[model samples]
Target chain A: MKVHVIGIGLIGGSMVLDIKSLHPDATIYGIDTNESHLAEAITLGVIDKVGTFDDLAEADFVIVSVPVDVALTLMPKVLDAIGDNTIVFEVGSTKIPICEAVANHQRRRNFIATHPIAGTEFSGPSAAIKNLFQGKTNIICEVEKTTFKLQEKALDLFRSLGMRIRYMDPKSHDKHIAYVSHLSHISSFMLGKTVINKEKDEQDIFDMAGSGFESTVRLAKSSPAMWTPIFKQNKKQVVKSLEEYISNLTLFKELLANDDFDAIFNEMQSVNKIKEILNGMKK
Target chain B: MKVHVIGIGLIGGSMVLDIKSLHPDATIYGIDTNESHLAEAITLGVIDKVGTFDDLAEADFVIVSVPVDVALTLMPKVLDAIGDNTIVFEVGSTKIPICEAVANHQRRRNFIATHPIAGTEFSGPSAAIKNLFQGKTNIICEVEKTTFKLQEKALDLFRSLGMRIRYMDPKSHDKHIAYVSHLSHISSFMLGKTVINKEKDEQDIFDMAGSGFESTVRLAKSSPAMWTPIFKQNKKQVVKSLEEYISNLTLFKELLANDDFDAIFNEMQSVNKIKEILNGMKK
Candidate 1:
């Protein structure tokens, strides 16, 4: 099998690492506008060779794993470049924009929209690791738009990566992800910014941060190059989520300021239900 | 050596799990007001025997591991009851109030103000595990107030738990921790509350939450009984930290509303330094 992968960064590079194990005979072509990332992906043995969009026609599968904005622009072009039977898919965080971008394309039936809900805070080709997608949920949005043959093939590939597939409309996927994923990144970034802004003594932050702080602020270390586009692409849903998050924080602040320890304690207890919710998610 | 451990829950129980190896000959007595906890601790073999505050006089070491409010109320009493040369210490999240509460006590020299910067989201004796403090930081505040002999013994105990000790003024410890540890719990709780409030569909939250959301909101699963008193005791510093966090979120919200991608991107990149800060803390 010949596979063409766009944007040799975390998602794409990780896919290369895991998928190559399942298809050792597969020839993978790495494509990235960032020449350095393409080279690094090769050096990391995440892909077999360097190629371009021009090579899409000969590929059995084409995966776009670039920033959402770049994916939005590249989706239509990729569909135009790929052969009739070749399957194309993207693993972008925000699905709506990209799905809408290629909705009317003549070759739309060949393209699948996916959001693999797995990643570490780290980024780049060096950050890629095998089994990154194992036991993780993969949201496949607007699957009905894709041809049955390609959808089956994509599902097989996702299964091979040990990902459980969930189908949803692009709109629902974006909105729900705004709360569960995007909002989390925003909250962590803001927390890191708030603490960094207040505690100018870096050593103090270094010394005082415990496991809780480390876990809570871990997403703040994520690449801005990737998240900025995702936030922008899903701005409407993200903004709504942020407004609610800000309102909740304000209420919590008032509870603290009022010395209403009971309310604060109850509020925390109420949210403690997230443990069960997270457990369900893991399953 | 005879040791009396107050509040045989997560911290104290974990201490028993780890420190037992280093001081196998030590006669450890569990002291908790909660009857069930005392029974469970004894049943779990976390302590050799169950004791009470009255046992303080016989203890070569008195480790108070209760909520900060309880610790503050008990620190003076514990100090009064312990004999000279008995190294008394409490591992409360907040340090200033407990330190100040016993500052002028006749036995203050025997009490060491320490906050072991370690814990899981879970609570109780059932949640306790061995080596929870391995390679974690243990902040010892107001070291000058404790006698040098007690300080060395406390350090040795903390080191035996595989902790690195950092000394600071109680005021500094409380303030810095308000941003790093306490603020993280608040942010996580508020994040969980916000998502729970908005998503209304609990199933949606469970289905959509990824690893990032789980990590960012993990502290929301923490025990309210343990956290409430810490927040109440460190109210000033916590409120200050929460205000800053809320302000940062509000500002980020506005940036999203205004499509100020550059500002948001720059803010995230700046906070990205936390990766290095956290790495240093780990080492």
Candidate 2:
């Protein structure tokens, strides 16, 4: 099998590595507009060859792994370029836009919209790793639009990479991902901005940042180019989640101001239910 | 030398283990309001023995590691029970209240208000690990309050455990920590609450929680008993930091609602400065 991965950065590059590692006979082609990333991906041996758009015509599988905005624009082009028998899939955070963009394409049945719920804060081709999708969930949206053979191919590919797959509607996937993923990036970036703006002394922040701060602010280090588009594409749901998040923080502030120790403590306890939720996520 | 550690949970127990590991001949005594933690500390070999308030008189060094509210109240009692030559210190997140609570104590000169900014969300004796303080900063506030000899003792002990030290005023310490540490906890808890409330199907949350959400929400798993007191004692500063945080989120919401993509994208780019800040912290 031959797989063409476009915009080979963290997610795409890592997927290339995973596919190559799992299917040694499968040939992998990398595509990226960023010359430096292509160079790094080639140097890192993340792909068997760095190829151009022409490669998509012959690709058994074409994976769109770019910024959400670019994914929306480029996905249709890739779909138009691919053969009817070729399977095209996207690993974008927001599914609705990408799904809609390709909804009317003649080869729409050849496309599968998937988001493998896995990533590190780091970006670029150099950040890619083998088995990045192992033990993680890959959400497949609007599976009915995908041809049975292509869906089977995508499932086999994810399964071979050791990922569990779940199905959801594209709209529902966008809403759920906003709360679970997109909002997290915003909260982290804003928290980082808040602290950096207030604590001008870099040395003070260094001295005082514990693991709690590190973990909470980890997403702040994510690439702005990658996240900004996600936030924009999922704006409505992201806005809703952000409002509720702000409301929650404001409620906490009021509780603190009133010295309502019981309320403060109980609210934290309620939120602490996240422990069970996180533990569940681990499984 | 004899050292008594109060509240032998994650931070306290880890400190005991590190101290004992470094000073093989030092006899360490454990104390906690929770009997189970005290017993677990001993069974885990984190301390040489278990003791009560009476043990302070004989302790060459006394380390208070209880919750902030309890630390403020219990510190004075420990001071009253300790010898004039005893070197006392604490590892609370907030320092102003503890510093103020013991400001005029007769043995104030023997006390050192310190915050070792390191810990995981998990707590209790089982969470203790060796070398917790290695390569971490131990922030000592109001060092002038400590007698020269006791200061030397505390400095030497922290050095022995592979920790670097920085000195700051308690007021600045609490305010800075409120932004860097306290605000992070609230953000994490609220993020967890927002997601959990929005995603009623636990399976969706479990499947969709990528590393981004997991890292951002990790601190929500922290103990309420431990965090509640810190929030109560540092209420004012926490409220201020939280207000700034909510304001930032609100502004971002407006930008998103307006479809000001450039504004949204640029804000994230600016906030991406956190990557540099976090890189500096790692150094």
Candidate 3:
């Protein structure tokens, strides 16, 4: 089997690593715009060889894992290069833009739109590790748009990687993700900014910040190179989510200002239900 | 040695457990307004016995770990009851308010204000665990107010438990903590609220939420009874932190609305320095 992977960063690199383990007989070929990343991925054993879009026709499976902005333009070109039997899946955080980008493609039936809800704050090929998708949700949007043969093959591969599959339309996927994923990143970034601005004495932050602060601001460490495009592609939903988040923070401030401890307690107690919601999300 | 712990919940309970391990020969006595907590602590073996303020004279050390509002009234009383030789430490998140609460007490010299910057989102005696303070920061405010002999005893015990101590004025402690600790809780609670409000269909959240969302909103699961008093006690600083956080979110929203992806990328990239700050905080 020939597996071709593009943009071999964390997600793509991790996918190929796991694929190597699962399908050792399959030749893993990597394609990345960054020459260094491709070389590093080979050195790190993330891929068996370097390949390109020209090599797509020979691939049994093609995984496109670039930034969403790059995926928008690359998707149509990728489809044009793949054979009828070859299956392609683009794993990105946002769905609608890429879905629309390939919506009118000649080989649209060969592509599957996936948002694997898994990752760490770190990025890069070196950051990739095996079993990343294990027990994590993989939201596949527009599954009906793909040909039955390729859809079955992709689903089988994703299931083999131990991912729980959930199908949704691109619109709902983008909107809901804006709240659950994108909004968390924005909230974390702003929280980090707020705390950093106030605590100019960096040593003070290092000395006083507890586990709660670390966990709450952990996402602020995510790569801006990858995330900026995601926020851009999902701008409308992202902006709406930010507005709601800012309003909530403003209300919390007012509750504190007015010495309304009861209201503050109630607000927190209600949100405490997230523990159960998160438990459900946990693998 | 006799150690008396007030409000036998997470912090207090955990402290007594560690002290028991470190000083096996010492007697551990628990005191709490909730009768069941005392019974539970004894059952959990968090303490050897239940004691009252009347038994304070026998204590070599007294740990007051109740809510800060409760500490306002309780600190003076705890100080009044302790003998001259008995040292007292109030472990609460805010400092200046409680420091001022017992500023002129006859036994002020016997008390130390400390905030162990460590805890989980979980609360209660059952939530307590051993080694909770190991490799964690214990911020001691107004350490000078405590008698030399008692300060030596308390600092020795904190070190024995593997705590790294940093001394700060009560005013500085509260203001700095508002950014590192208090602001994080507020941000997590608000993020939880925003997501919960928009995802009226909870299944979407459960399926779509990733590790980032879970980590960012984890503090929202914290006990309201524990946090409400901290926020109330440090209202001024907490409000200031919240305003800054809200303003950053507002500015981020404007950047998004304007399609200024470069500025957004730069903003996140700058905040990414939290990686190093947080790394320094790691044990």
Candidate 4:
């Protein structure tokens, strides 16, 4: 099989690794606007070769994995560049824009909009590792928009990477992810910013950063180039999620101000149910 | 040496696990208002025996690992109840109130203030594990208040657990921890609450919680019985830290609302430096 990977960074690069393992004979071509990332992906053996847009015509499958804005612009072009038999898909976080962009395209039946619910707080090809998608959730939005054969082929690849596929409309996918994923990035970034703003002594943070702080602020290390676009593309839903988070924080702050220990305790106790929900998420 | 571990839960139980490895022949007594927890500790071999408050006089070292509000109440009593030779110390998250509670007590010199910056999301005797403190930081506040001999003994135990000890005043310890530790708990709890509030489908949360959301909300699963008192006792400092966090979030929200993607991107880029600080904290 001939496969072409765009935006050869963490998500796309990881896909290359796992997909190669599943189909050892697959020849994976890579593309990225960042020249260095393309070189790094090649050095890391994440792709068989670096390829250009013209190369897309010969590929059997094209994986678009750039920042959402770039992916939106590139989606139709990728469809235009690919042969009739080629399946074009993207692994962007926000799905609505990309889906809407290709909605009226004649080749829309060949494009599948996907958001794989898997990542670490690292970026670039070097961060790619084996089994990045294993046992993870993959949301395939507007799967009905794709031809049955292309959808099944995408599902085969998703299954090969050990992902459980779910179908949703692009709108629901964006809204749901706004709550579960994008809001977390904002919360963590704000947390790191808050601590950095208050504690001038970095040594103090180093000494006191327990596992709790480490986990809570871990997402602050995510790439701005990747995430800023996600938040911007999903602005309305993300803003709603952020408002809910800020409201919850405000209520807790009021409880703290009033020294209403019981209310705070009850609030945390109720939220502690997340433990059960999260425990179910672990493999 | 005879050791009495009060409140026999995660912290105290973990200490007993490490302390017994260091002083194999020492007898460890467990005490808790929760009778079942004491019994579970005994069953799990976390303690040599269950003991009472009256056992304080017989203990050469008293480790008070209870909730902060309870620790504040028990600090003076444990001091009043123990011998001058007994080195009484509490492993509570907040230090100011506990330190202040016993400031003028006649036996104050025998009591040491410590906050070992190590823990897991889980709690209780069953949640205790070996070497939980290894390569972790142990903050000893108000070191001058304790006698040299007692401080050295505490240092010996902390060293045996493979900890690096740093000394700070009670006020500074509470303030710094508010930013790094306490604020993290609040952020995580609020994040969990916010997500749970929006995603009515528990299955959706269980499906979509990536490592980012999982890590960011890990502390939300923490025992409310334990954290409620810590926040209550350190309300002033925590409120201050939380206000800064909320302000930061509000700014980020405004940036999102205005579609100021550059500002959001720059903010996260700066906070990404936390990756280095957190890296230094890892074992």
Candidate 5:
């Protein structure tokens, strides 16, 4: 098996590491815009060798793990460079933009749009770890657009990495992810901003922050370079989710202002069901 | 050592577990309006026996671990019933209300205002676990108001439990905790509410939610019984924090609506400093 990974970072680097372990005979090649990252990934033994677009012709699979914005301009060119037998799949947060980017390409059937719902706040090749997708949901969008043979090959590879596959249209994928992923990043970032701004006025405020605060703001540490484009591409849904989020906050604040402890308790009680949902997600 | 704990929930139960471990000679007594909770505490070995207010007169130490609203009414009574040498402390989230609740009590010198910033999302005796306070901050407020000898007993017990004590005035503690602890809960609860409300329309949306969403919304699983009174007691500061948080969210939304990805990127980048604050908290 010949595998080429582009924009080697946490997701891409992790994917290839699993491939190496699962397919011992596979030869892994990598390309990254950051020369240092490519070098670091090589030093870290994340990839077997460095490769360029010219190497795509001989690759069995090409994993595109660049930022959503970069994926927009790079997906078509990647499709142009791949051989007829090559399968190219891009893993990004938002789907419709990437799906539409190559909807008219000559080798459209060679591409698959997927978002394996997995990651940590950290990024870069050095941050990658193996088995990140194990038991994680991998939402494959526009699977019908990809040729059956290529889809089978990609699905088999993903399955080998222990990813649970779920099929959805690109539109639903983007909208649903806005609530689950994109909106959460915004909520976390803004929470961090609000507290950081207060930290300026109160130097020792963070000393009082506990595990609850840490968990609530953990995603604020996510990579802006990767997230900015996701928010831009999924702007409509992200905006809608934020509006609903802000509205809920405002209502909660109003209940607090009115000294309506009963309403406040009910509000929190209603959302406590998230515990079960999170338990399900954990499994 | 005779120790009586009022409200044998997560905080009180966990504290007694540590107290029992550290002071083998200590006899732990628990009182709760929920009779079943007191029974469960004994079954879980979180407390040695159930006691009433009458037992408070013979207690050497009294730990109040009820909601802030309830604490406002019960604190003075506990202070009244304690022996002259007894040290009584309350571990409620809001300090101002609890501190003022017994400002003029005859046994004010026997009371120490401390908010041990430790707990999990779960509540009740079943959620109690040992060493929950280890390496965690325990904020001591209005220490000057307590008698030196009585304060020593409580401080020594806290130190034995491995808590790092920080002294702050009641006013300062309430205001600072609002931004770090209280506001984060509102943000998390509202985040859960936004996603849960969306889940009604989009049944499978949660399947797309990953660890990031789970982390950001974890505090939503917190007991409303414990939190509603916290928001009620610390209303003013919590309201102020909510306004600032909402304002930041609104601004971030506008930035996204206007396609100002640069600003959005900068926003997250700036708040990325929370990584260090959280790292500091971990220490």
Candidate 6:
């Protein structure tokens, strides 16, 4: 099987590496608009051969893993260029727009909308890893939109990469992702902004930052080009989640201001249930 | 020199282990209000022996690592019990209260009020590790209150543990930490609550939680008992930080609602400076 990955950045590059490692005999090609990233991906050996959209006709599968806005604009064009036997899939954070963009395409059935629900704060081809998707959840939205054979092929591909897959509607996927993923990026970014804004002396921030600050602010380091669109695409749900998050923080603040020790303790106790939920999710 | 660690939970137990490993000949004693933690500390060999508060007077150095509230309450009493030759220090998140509480004590100068800005989401003695403080910032607040000899002892111990010491005022320390440390915990807890509350079906969260969510919400798994007092003590700064955070989220939400892609992208791009700040801090 020949696999061609577009936008060979973190997610796309890691996918290529993972696939190559799992199936050594499989031929993999890569494409990216960024010359540096293409060079880096090629140097890293993330792809067997670096190709362009012109070569899409010969590929058995084409994976679009670009920024959300780019994915929306280029997905259909990639679909149009692919052969009927070729399966096209996307690994984007937001799904509604991407799903809608290709819903009416003649080869819509050849496309599958998937979000592997995995990533780190880093980006670019250098950030790619062979087992980036291991033991992680992969959310496949509107899977029925794809042909049965293509769906099976995609499933086998994800399984080989050691991912657990789940199905959901595009709308629901957007909403839940806003709460779990998009809002996290915003929270982290804003927290980082707030701290940087408050601490005029950068040296103070450097001297005072511990692991807590590092972990909490890790996602703030994510690529703005990628996340800015995600926040825009799923604005409503992201806003709602952000509002609830803000309200919760405000109430905790009020309790603190009142010096209501019991209230503060009780609130923390209530939220501590997060441990149980997180543990359950791990299982 | 002999050392006695009070409340051998994560911070204390880890301190004991690190101190022991650094100075193998140093006889270490563990003291805790929780019997189970005491036993676990002993079994983990975090200490040479388990003892009571009475053992504090016999040690050359006494380390108090407990919850902020408990530390504030017990520190003065412990200082009263310790001899002038013994050096006493604390590793708590907040420093103002403890400093104020022990200000007028006769042996106030014998006590070093320090906040080592290091910890993990896990708690209890079992969470202890050998080099928890290595290369981490150990902020010594209001050193004026500590005697020169005792301060030297504290500095020597921390230096031996491979920590770089930073000096700051207690009030400033509390305020800065409120933004950098305390607020992160609240943001995480509330983020966890919002997701767990919104996603009624636990299975959904379990299915969708990626590394992004896990890293963002990791602090939510922290012990409420440990965090409640931190929010209480650092109430003012937390409230201010919380308000700013809410306003930022609301503004982002409004931008999203308007589908103002330019505005959204610009804001995210501006906030992307966090990457530079975090990277600088990591170095």
lDDT of 6 by residue, B1-283 (tens): 7899988888888887888888889998888888888788778898788866777777788989888889888988898788769999888888889888888989888888888878899898889987888888899988877878878888998999888899999989988888788878888888887887798887888888877788888898888888887777777788888887777777777877788878877776776776777777556
- Candidates 3 and 4: which is better by lDDT? 3
**Which of the two candidates, 2 or 5, achieves a greater DockQ against the reference?**
2
User: Candidate 6's C-alpha lDDT?
Assistant: 0.84
Q: Tell me the deviation in Å of residue B273 in model 4.
A: 1.1
- Model 2 chain B: weakest 10-residue lDDT segment is B274-283
For DockQ, the strongest prediction is 3
What candidate 5 gets wrong by more than 4 Å, as runs, is: A201-203, B201-203
Candidate 2 local Cα displacement, residue B192, angstroms: 1.1
Candidate 2 residues A133-219, lDDT tens each?
A: 889999999999899998998899899889999999989899888898889999998998899899888778888998889888888
- Candidate 5 interface RMS: 1.2
- Looking at model 3, residue B225 earns an lDDT score of 92
| Whole-model Cα lDDT of every candidate shown, in order | 0.88, 0.88, 0.92, 0.90, 0.90, 0.84
Q: What is the TM-score of chain A in candidate 5?
A: 0.98
- lDDT string for model 5 (A100-202, tens) is 8998999999999899999999999987899999999999998899999999999999999999999999998988899988988989999888888887853
Question: What's the TM-score of chain A alone for every prediction?
Answer: 0.97, 0.98, 0.98, 0.98, 0.98, 0.97
Q: After aligning candidate 6 to the native by TM-score, how far in Å is the CA of B197 from where it should be? A: 0.9
lDDT of 2 at A106: 87
Q: Give the 10-residue window scoring lowest on summed lDDT in candidate 4 chain B.
A: B274-283
Residue range with the least summed lDDT across 10 consecutive positions in model 6 chain A: A274-283
Per-residue lDDT over B77-143 for candidate 3, one digit per residue giving the tens place of the 0 to 100 score: 8888989899999899999889999999999999989999889998878988999999999999888
In candidate 4, position B50 carries an lDDT of 85
State the lDDT of candidate 6 residue by residue for A1-283, as single tens digits. 8899998888888998988887889888888888888788888898888887878887888989999889988998998788878999999999999998998999999999999988888899899987988888889998887899989999999998989999999999999988888888888878887887788887788888878777888887788788877877787788788888777777776777788878877776776776776777677
Report how far off residue B2 is in candidate 1 (Å).
1.3
C-alpha TM-scores of all predictions: 0.97, 0.98, 0.98, 0.98, 0.98, 0.96
DockQ of each: 0.85, 0.86, 0.91, 0.90, 0.81, 0.72
CAPRI quality band, candidate 1:
high
- For lDDT, the strongest prediction is 3
CA lDDT, candidate 4, residue B146: 88
